[model samples]
Target: MNNENSKLTISRIIQAPRSTVWKAWSEKEHFEKWWIPEPITCKVVKMDMTPGGGFETLMSENGEEFQPHVEGCFLEIVPLERIVFTTVLTEGWKPNDPWLSMTAIITMEDASSGTKYTAEALHKNPEDSNKHLEMGFEEGWGTTIDQLEKLIMKLA
Candidate 1:
């Protein structure tokens, strides 16, 4: 898929350093707290960040049953800098056709104020990209990023 129509991205300057942001994304404890917007909980099922490792999570609104959130494979992990994962493949590079498929690229860079965090979700086609956008891709991801910044504020 081409970059112009088959992708959605969010870029924001957070008040924390890249190290802090990296920890929030890398560490399980910090990740769970802000990965999914709160009230709705996000549980890390597997977080092996190495290439070809599994990256999965479960989400629940209540205290009881949890539903599958994302089942993806880590395509690349550049410590404190970048992370690339795809729903097109599971762990060990196994193929899987997920209900909603996309590859997410997360980047952290040292900015003047703090970290410039960017997230991009790339779909295989324009239709898939539009579907994700119609599903509130911006609002949902923006809310999570806001939550993350708040969490970092508390930590700082």
Candidate 2:
């Protein structure tokens, strides 16, 4: 992994508590509800909320189904404060190899009446970073986040 040239980070202040935000991510049902953008549906194949556990989510876009994009094991889970995971060679805690891997760090902190959430994705290289950027990283991630905000607010 060429860490020096690859990074994608986004932070948003959600109008909800840290617990709410954490539940939105840690719960399969809640995650599926907001993990995809409009016109795209996501199915959580499996989610084991523990370090070394695994997760996968299938996405269908515009009537076309795509294979799971994320197959990773959790590295850390710190309740409402942070979550760390990696998309490396693994399936339900089993190891294997395919494409590039990434470590995603999600942090949550109290912010007045809500929560300040930050997502930082570290990629393998500048090329991979550029590839993700070209794949609508801003729009896609932004929309998913918007969906999360809406879902949390609705439940709040």
Candidate 3:
């Protein structure tokens, strides 16, 4: 159930229960523990997990902070199953460019004694998708998922 041309999608099978993985994503405290890699701390500036709510995260590594990534309103949220939110990077959700917004859909499914996590990012055009790929998205996202797996396993 994936299309290569339908934006960007990353899938992983995490060895954890659905509830635990869902909590790791929905809870801000649990989210910070695995959202970034080692030596880099991730903090949620603001997270309101609901439709029309904005979520912001700040990534700091070696005491140096990179520009925070902000996602604007959630278009859809299905508890323990899926989250569809719009990605808009701006201070306090205000779009400076007014032309950069992507729809990100994260889905969770029950697998064989584990959970399937799928992150699908729908960009406005092919250029945006190419940009994400050029940004070492595979390695970056793989590391994030690896971090998540380690954290969730500790909980289990």
> In candidate 1, what are the lDDT values of residues 33-132, reduced to their tens digit?
9988778999999999999999999999995789999999999999999999999999999999999999999999999999999999999999999999
List model 3 lDDT by residue over 11-122, tens digit each.
9999998898898889999998888776788888877777767777777876566556554666678999998877664334455343445778999999996999998878
Candidate 3: C-alpha lDDT? 0.78
Query: TM-score of each candidate?
Result: 0.97, 0.89, 0.85
Candidate 2 segments whose C-alpha is farther than 4 A from its true place: 1-4, 62-66, 91-93, 98-100
Model number with the top lDDT: 1
* Every model: Cα RMSD to truth: 0.9, 2.1, 3.4
List pairs with backbone clashes in candidate 1. Answer: none
- What TM-score does candidate 3 reach? 0.85
- Order of quality (TM-score): 1, 2, 3
Better of 2 and 3 by TM-score: 2
